[model samples]
Target: MTALDPFTDALDCPLYVVTATAAGERAGCLVGFASQCSIRPARFIVWLSKANRTYRVAARADRLAVHLLGHDQDHLARLFGGATGDMTDKFTRTAWHPGPGGVPVLDEAPVWVVGRVQSRFDGGDHCGFLLAPEAAQHPGGDGVRLMFLKDGPDISPGHPAD
Candidate 1:
């Protein structure tokens, strides 16, 4: 395997806290690998590391909610990004409610969307979940400036698969 440095290629893409609830259990995590993949039909995709607890929950989820973090929401980013759901309850520390398909929608987020899982693909260490937007809510704001690489704690992936 070729070792490529992600640090050099790390773009300041929007950061999101993606949550999925299945079988009465909820899981969430900070996500960086996501984007709008289609314009005509308005489709988006979020990639999750297989080792993440959120991925395990999302695998059985019919829908997933994506919440964009504002510039000052570093704590939200820490709960989902710096901490691992395997050992901690990330949801208990955040404000959220059940949304479409019972997925957890972060209340503090300025913008959020719930989408039905359209397809899933294996991307080696991560899995790509293509979503079809079913519902969206944009609570008015300055369109919260997205969190980036330089904004939060630099924690190493707690799991081996990450």
Candidate 2:
């Protein structure tokens, strides 16, 4: 693999905690690989690392909820990013409500969207989950400044090896 400095090249976009539930199991993780892919159909895509517990749950899920964190929501990021779901119940520690498709939605999030998985594409170590927006809600106004890399250091990867 080509060695590159992600710290220097990384763009600070809004961080999101994506959650998915399927077969009585639920998983959520902090995601950095996400973007709006299409305009006409308004499709969005979020990529999850193959090694992430969330990805395994997502594979069987019909829908996923993407929640945008505010500048002060670092705890949410840590819960989903720093710790592995295989060892702990992330949802039990956080305040959440049932979202579309019965997915867990973090109550502290400023904005969130529930989308149906339309397609999936494998990209090396991550799998791109293409979503079609089914419902969305933004509790905060448009003036809210989302958490980004410029706010602090790039910390989404959560692991030193990554």
Candidate 3:
């Protein structure tokens, strides 16, 4: 662990699911490394693991969708996080519809945003996708509890984190 672990370990931010479509193929995965990086003019970034199938698809995709999971939506998180897309068809197991640029938008998410890929930053074992909001769906949260990192440290990553 890096020196940042002391601070990072105590953190339990909300989890998210990111989906993308390219060349008629779709992919998505559980993401813990994403955040809004700008306020004025609005910008958000999603870091996709190089080992994830979604990352490969997103590399060729022009747009992507980011869905926020409610605290009680462990099943949704597990489905995205527990299995590799190489072996499982995640969309078939969940409710979703095509959104702008044909990105898959999760139906059960309380909030979701579709963004045009502004740029790509390839670094380390993951590439950061800089997104500019294109469209969004806000069903309006009524006590929508969000999912966090407390799902247990042993939670198997859909793909090995390496």
Deviation from native of the Cα of residue 150 in model 3, angstroms? 2.5
Model 2, span 17-125: residue lDDT tens: 9999999998998887798999989999999888888999999999999988888787887788887888889999999998888988888888889999999999988
Kindly list the per-residue Cα lDDT of model 3 for residues 17-77, writing each as its tens digit.
9999999999999988889999987999999999999999999999999998987787888
* Candidate 1 pairs with clashing backbones: none
Model 3 / residue 47 / CA error / Å: 0.4
lDDT of 1 by residue, 1-162 (tens): 335657646566788889999998899988888999999889999999998999999999999999888888888887888778889988889888889878999999888999999999999999999999998987666765766767755655546544
Better of 1 and 3 by lDDT: 3
- RMSD for each of the candidates: 2.2, 2.5, 1.5
Cα lDDT listed for each candidate: 0.86, 0.85, 0.90
Candidate number with the higher lDDT (2 or 3):
3
Please tell me which model should have the higher TM-score, number 1 or number 3. Answer: 3
Clashes of 2: 0
